[model samples]
Target: MQACANWIDGGPQPSRADQWLDVTNPATGAVIARVPLSTAEEVEQAVQSAERAFADWGCWPPVERARVMFRFQQVLRDHFDELARLIVEDNGKTLAEAKGSVQRGIEVVEFAAGIPSLGMGDVLKDIAPGVDCEMIRQPLGVVAGFTPFNFPVMVPLWMIPIALACGNTFVLKPSERAPLAGLRIAELFAECGAPPGTWNVLHGTARVAEQLMADPRIQAVSVVGSSPIA
Candidate 1:
């Protein structure tokens, strides 16, 4: 069986974990691959990488950040069919459904690419006797995404692009049941020139999710899973 490991600091890192989770083809009931059941220490390492990257990434001008998203969107478009195939192979979804899932993700990347204009802040100058205030959307340091297996591509897409476009470094903990798609997408992000440590992935179960939720460094968390998982 093929084994998949986590993506950390812009590359795949073999897990130090002693345990693994089996990924099964839901339609055929056959085990396809094994993913690491990452330890808290391992998950924390990814978080630390994001934290370290945040100082620079979070300070980058919005236009510069949008440039990265532009390249990311193009790279994703170039691999549209390939990504859909990975989704079907990993999750046992029909090819059509997998393509739809991947397309939905692509749309989010498109929206993120426009963040320089769409996400701009506002200012009311001299509102009250020479006083002015500005409300700007700023990056929250070290954001984390916890996605489920069912919508592997769509769910992570909903979070990662926007977070990165808005200048936040991210740590993703994709569901262990369907880890391949996330790993593959992370590879695309790297190919598009996203800096190391700006985006990271760790594969594991609820234990790792809970650790992420409890960590102080994770300023924001997004979950698109079951009620229990949320």
Candidate 2:
């Protein structure tokens, strides 16, 4: 079976833990691959990596960041079908559903590509006689996201692109059961010139979530999962 590893720092790296979780193809009930169940320390490392990257990424000019996002959007569009197929193989969703789901993800990236404008703050001109009031939007450092298995591409795309576009480095912990899609997304981000440590994917079980929630380095945690898991 293929061993799915964590996307740490800037590249694909195997989890330190020997314990593995089986990734099944829901359509065939077959064990297609195995993903490492990362430990708390591994999660911490991922967070630290994000934190380390935050200053540079967060300080990048909005247009530069948007350019990278624009490239990412094009790359996503070019390989949209292959990504949807991976989602289908991993999540066992219908090809049409997978395509639609991945398209929604690409849409979010498209939205993120406009962050230069979308993330702009309003200005109150000449407030109080020569004094101006401005509403400024800032990027939180080292944000984290926990995604579900069902709509892996769509949900995470909703979180990551916007977060990275807003200048926050991201640490994503995708569901172990359908992780290949997320890993591939990380690879594409790098291929499209996204900086390492800016988008990291850590695969694991509940411990990963606990660590994310407890970590000070993770400024925010966004999740898309069932209430039972929430």
Count of steric clashes across candidates, in order: 0, 0
TM-score of 2: 0.95
Clashing pairs in 1: none
Q: What is the C-alpha lDDT of each candidate?
A: 0.88, 0.88
The root-mean-square deviation over C-alpha atoms between each candidate and the true structure, in angstroms, is 1.3, 1.4
Estimate the lDDT of model 2. 0.88
Instruction: List, residue by residue over 96-204, the lDDT tens digit for candidate 1.
Output: 9999999999999989999889889999999899899999888889989889888888899999999899889999988888888988898889987667899999888
